[model samples]
Every structure is written in structure tokens, then in C-alpha cells.
Target: MQEPIRQSYEAAKELYAQHGIDVDQVLRELEKLKISVHCWQGDDVRGFLFQDQALTGGISVTGNYPGAARTPNELRSDLEKAFSLIPGKHKVNLHAIYADTEEKPELDELEPRHFQRWVDWARERGLGLDFNPTCFSHEMSKDGLTLSHPDPAVRRFWIDHCKASRRIGAYFGEQLGQTCVTNVWVPDGYKDTPADRMAPRKRLKASLDEVFAEKLDPSHHLDAVESKLFGLGSEAYTVGSHEFYMGYAIQNHKMICLDAGHFHPTEVISNKLSSLALYTSGILLHVSRPMRWDSDHVVVMDDELLDIGRELVRSRLLDTTHIGLDFFDASINRVAAWVIGTRNTIKALLRAMLEPVEALKKAELDGDFTTRLALTEEFKSYPFGAVWDYYCDKSGVPVRENWLAEVKTYEQNVLLKRGSRASIVN
Candidate 1:
């Protein structure tokens, strides 16, 4: 297998050289690109903070495959397993609800000490950390509103939570020596058509102002606001619509999060990157696969994913873009979901890096429409798989579907044993 992969990669290197493309340089650049893997996938979005409550905030995780991580130790162990299969040293995105604490502290009272274990874990593995404030799944958010809640008391609660979250995020960066991205997303909207929409938007704006009143050093932490078109219960109106956050991000000079699953079914985030980059200081991408609505399915190496990679690479916007996965699937092995999604995202980036971007841009600039289109179509057939296989081998991971067998073996030895014990106890 090693000999065949080496031969294939050598042939691919020569083929790319014909078009003035450097496969070796592309692989090297890919090694530098990191995707922040979400921790929610390991536990089906069930954080340890509130184990008894049902998932809320207009989002739901479907299917119940056994072996969901029940504690912080288990979740971290699962993440380690998933990362070993993936090729790059990536970051871990965490939610406030995942804190390893014995007391059920209110969201506003959360402190950095609660997450010291996670920081130590990341430091030990040389991984970066990203964070999110959990604004859902609590009694305060049962009304499908948070920052935009009409009651001043309820709104203030969420505001305090977000404020504390920023401090915690900055702590992660200060300790790890990597800037942490703390994204704020609220599920505030109406289930049915509301008589007035401006009120909610107004309230949301003021709430955000209060939450961000404290300034944190940009070197340590960055703040981002995420928007959604609609959600499970808030179908009629979503307070944090794309337009609302875009305008806020521009005025506030903050990073705006573009969630792939939060847009209309026909809309893809690939075409929006260049436009947003012109106005915002940076962008945070919540890379997820949307099935008609904001389903948050596991990502695949599909057209839209490839387009996102191409646009990021061609426009040279990678430096300003923070890539993170956002999906939860419990029907299969949760660890496998993380491995598959992260690997596919990496594959898309590798393909984008291998493109003859300079040549294509010259054709466009020269007004050679026919040549540009021809080259665009021709490059699609490039031996991207060979390069991908070689990358896996070099990274010390299995070279293809071979990784699947390892996951199955892990399930039989680890996951299955857990499931069996749970069944017996029940």
C-alpha cells in the first residue's frame, strides 16, 4: 500500500507540474490550515452541566446511537480518538455548558477556573481552544428568547452570561498563547408572526452593546456574533437575522459568524465570504451541512464545501477566517462522525490549495472567458485523491477507509462495553 501511494503521488506531482502547480507546497500549506472541531458531537450536544434537561434553543439532535460521552473525561477521550485519525493539529471548540464542575452554577457566575482542566488538556496536546456561551437549554431560555426577551430581568441574565463568557475566553487565550474566538448565538424569535419586529431587534442591539461593553485585548481573544434565518420554534422571525448581525459587525468592528446551515436552502456561504471580508475585520464560519433547513448534519466533501475552500484560498482570506465545525449526529458512532467530517473538510482545503489559482486569475484578467471556463472544468479532474492519500500516510494516519476499521474496533472494545453496562443497569 505504501509503495502504490508513493508511485501515485509521484505521478500526481508530475501532472500538477504541467500547470505550474506545486503539489508539495500545497500539502505544506494544508498542514498549516486547522479546523476547530466542535466538542458537542461527542455527546450529542448533551453537556455535563445540565444532564437532566431536554435540549432546547430551537435546535434538536436526532437519533440515539450508544456510546455518547457522559462526562468530561469520556468526552476528552473520545476527542483524542477522533483527532488521532485526523491529520492536522486542530483546535477544540467548547460551550460554557461543558464546564467540569460539581456545582450547578448559573451561567452568569461561570469563571475560568471551571475550565482549567480543559485548558490543561489542550496545552498537553498542543491544541488551540475556541469557546461559545450556552444560551439555550435552560429555564431562562424556554420561551425561545434570550437577549431579545421583553422582560428586563431575563435579558440581563443572558447579558451577564455572555459577558462572563468573554472573560473566560480571554483566559483560554492568555493561558494557551493562542487567540480564542468566543461566538455568541441566541435563539430569540417568535414561533408565529409577531405584530412588531423592530422591538426585538432594538432590544437585541442594546443587549449586545451591554455584553460587549468591556473591552478585551484583541491579541488574547476575539468576539463574534452568529445569526440564523429561522429555527425549530422561531420559524416566523429570527431576531438575529443575517442583516442584523452584518450591520452590527460592521459598525462594531467585530467578527460575524456565517453558519452554513443558518441560511436559506438555496443559499450557500461560499459566495458570501468575499463580500463580508470587505467590511468586517474577520469572519467565523460554522461549517455544517444543512438538509433543506438548519439541520446541522455532518459535513461531506461536496460541491458547496469545495466552493467554500476555493473562495477562501483564491481570495487569500484564510488569515481572517476562523474555520470551525458545527454538527451533531448520534445515529452512528459519534467519534466516527468527528473523524469523517474533519477529514472531509481537510480534503476540501487540500483540493483548493492544489488549484492553479494564479493561472485561472490571469485568464480572467485577460478577458479570456473561454480559456478560464475550460481551465476551471479541467482542474476538477486533477488527481486530488492521490495527494490526499499521500498526506494521510505522511501524517501517520491510515491512508483511506482503513481508518474505519480502527473505529469499528474501538467501538467493539470501548463503546460497546459502555452500552452493555448501561443496558444492564437500566
Candidate 2:
């Protein structure tokens, strides 16, 4: 396998050299780009703190796949298995609800001490950490309104949670020596037509003002706000619409998160990157797959994913853009979901980096649309899979579908045992 990989890589290198695409340099750049793998996927968004509570606020996990991580250790172990199959070191994204603490603490009362275990794990593995405030699934959010809730106390509780989340995020950065992005996303909206929308927007604006009032150091922590078009219940009105957050983030000098599935089906975040880059200091991307809507399906190497990669590479937004995966699929092996989604994401970015961007730009500048389109289409069928295989082999990870064998072996030995234990307990 090594010999075949080396031979294919050499041939592919020569082919890419003819088109002015350096495959070696592209791999190096890809190594520098880290994708923050979300932790919720391992347990289907059922965080540690609120396991007894029903998942609410327009969020639902459809499948009951075996071997869902039931403890922090189990989740970390699953992550370790998934990471072994992946090629590079990456960060883990966590929500406030996933805190590990013996004492029951409210979301507003969360602290850095609660997440020290996660910090230790990340530090040991040479990985970074990112955070988010859980603004749903609690009693306060039972009515589907949080930051913009009419009750001042309800809004205050969420505001405090966000504030505490920032401190924890800053703590992660300080401990790990890597900047942590703390993103805020609230599931606050109405299912039916609202008679008064301005009031909620005004309240939300004021609440956010309080959340961002205490400015933290930029070196250790960066703040970002994510907006959604609509959710299962919030189909009629979403308090934090795209335009609202766009204006707020630009005004507040905060990074804006552009979720791939948070807009109209026809709309793509690739096209919005250039526009947002001009205003926002930095951008946080939540890359996910949407089946007609925001389904949070495991990401695939599809056309839109490729387009996103191309835009990021061509626009030179790698330095300012933070890429993170946001999807949970319980229908398949949980660990396999992480491996598949993450590998496809890296492959998409790798394919984009392997493109001859200068040639395409030159063709476009010279008004040669035909050459531009022709080269774009021609590059699609290049020996991308061969280069990807070589990268996997070089990184000491399994090449191609060979990783699946290890996952299957793990399922039989580790995952199946978990299911049997659960059945006996039940």
C-alpha cells in the first residue's frame, strides 16, 4: 500500500506541477488549518449537565445509535478513536452544558473549574478548544425564548451564562496557549406569526449589549455570534436573524458565525464570505450538511462543500476564518460520524488548495470566460483521491476506506459492549 501510494503521489505531483499547483505545499497549508470537531455529535447533543432534561428549543436527534458516549470519559475515548483515524491534530468544540463537575451548577454559575478536565485532555494531546453557550433545553428556555424573553430575570440568567461562558473560553486559551472562539447562538424565536417583532429584537439587542459589555483580552479569547434563518418551531420568526447579527457583529467588532445550513436552501455561505470579510474582523464557520433544510446531516464531499473550500482558499481568508464542524447523526456509529464528516471536510479543503487559482483568476481578468470555466471543470476530475491517500499514509493514518475496518472492529469490541450494558441497566 505504501509503495502504491508513493507511486501515485509522484505521478499526481508531476501532473499538478504542469498546472502550477504544488501538491506538497498544499498539504502543508492543510496541516496548518485545523477543523474544530464539535463534541455534541458523540452524544447527540445531550450534554452532561442536563441529561435528565428533554432536548427542546427546535433541536432534535433522530436516531438512537448504539454506543453514544454516556460519560465524559466515554466521550473522550470515542474522540480519541475518531482522532486516530483522522490525519491531523484538531480542536474540540464544547457547549457550556457539557461541563464536568460533581456539584450541580446552573448554567449562569459555570466556571473554568468545571471544564479543567477537558483542558487537561486537550493540553495532553496538543489540541486547542472552542466553546459555546447553551441557550436552550433548560427550564428558562421552555417557552422557546431566552435572551429576548419578556421576563427580565429569564433574560438575565442567559446573559450571565454567556458572560460565564466567555470567562471559561478565555481560561481555555490561557491554559492551552491558543486563542479560543466563544460563539453565542440562541434558539429564541416564535413558531406562529408574531404581532410585535421589534420588541423582541430590542430586548435581544439590549441583552447582547450586557453580554459583551465586559471586554476580554483578544489574545486569549474571541467572541462570535451565530444567526439562524429558522428552526423547527421558529419557522415564522427567528429573533437573531442573519441581518440582525451581521449589523450587531460589525458594530461591536465581534466575529460573525456563518452556518452552512442557516440560510435559504438556494443560499450558500461561500458567496457570503467576501461580503462578511469586509466588515467583520474575523469569521467563524459552522460547516454542516443540510438535506433540503438545516438537517445537521454528516458532511459529505459534495458540490457546495467544494465551493466553500474554493472560496476560502481563493479569498485568502484562512488566517481570519475559523472552520468548525456542526452536525450530529445518531443513525450510524457515533465515532464513525465524526471520522467521516471531518475527513470529507479536510478533503474538500485539500482539493481546493490543489487548484490553480492564479490561472483561473488570470483567465477571468483577461475576459476569457471559456478558459476559466474549462479549467474549473477540468480540475474537478484530477487525481485528488490519490493525493489524499498519500497524505493519509504519510500522516500514519489508514488510507482510503481502510479506516472503516478499524471502526468496525471498534464497534464490535467497544460500542457493542456499551449497548449491552445499557440494555441490562434498563
The parts of candidate 1 lying over 4 Å away from their true place are: 419-426
Tens digits of lDDT, candidate 1, 257-322: 999999999999999999999998899999999997898999999999999999999999989999
Kindly list the per-residue Cα lDDT of model 2 for residues 1-426, writing each as its tens digit: 589899999999999999988899889988888999999999889888878788887888888778888778888999999999999989999999899878799999999999999999999999999999999889999579999999999999999999999999999999999999999999999999999999999999999999999989899999999999999899999999999999999999999999999999999999999999988899999999988889999999999899899999999998999999999998999899999999999999999999999999999999999999999999989999999999999998999999999999999888877853244324
Residue 239 CA error for candidate 1 (Å)?
0.6
Clashes of each: 0, 0
lDDT of 2 at 285: 96
TM-score of 2: 0.98
lDDT on C-alpha atoms for all candidate structures: 0.92, 0.93
Looking at candidate 2, the ten consecutive residues that score lowest on lDDT are: 417-426
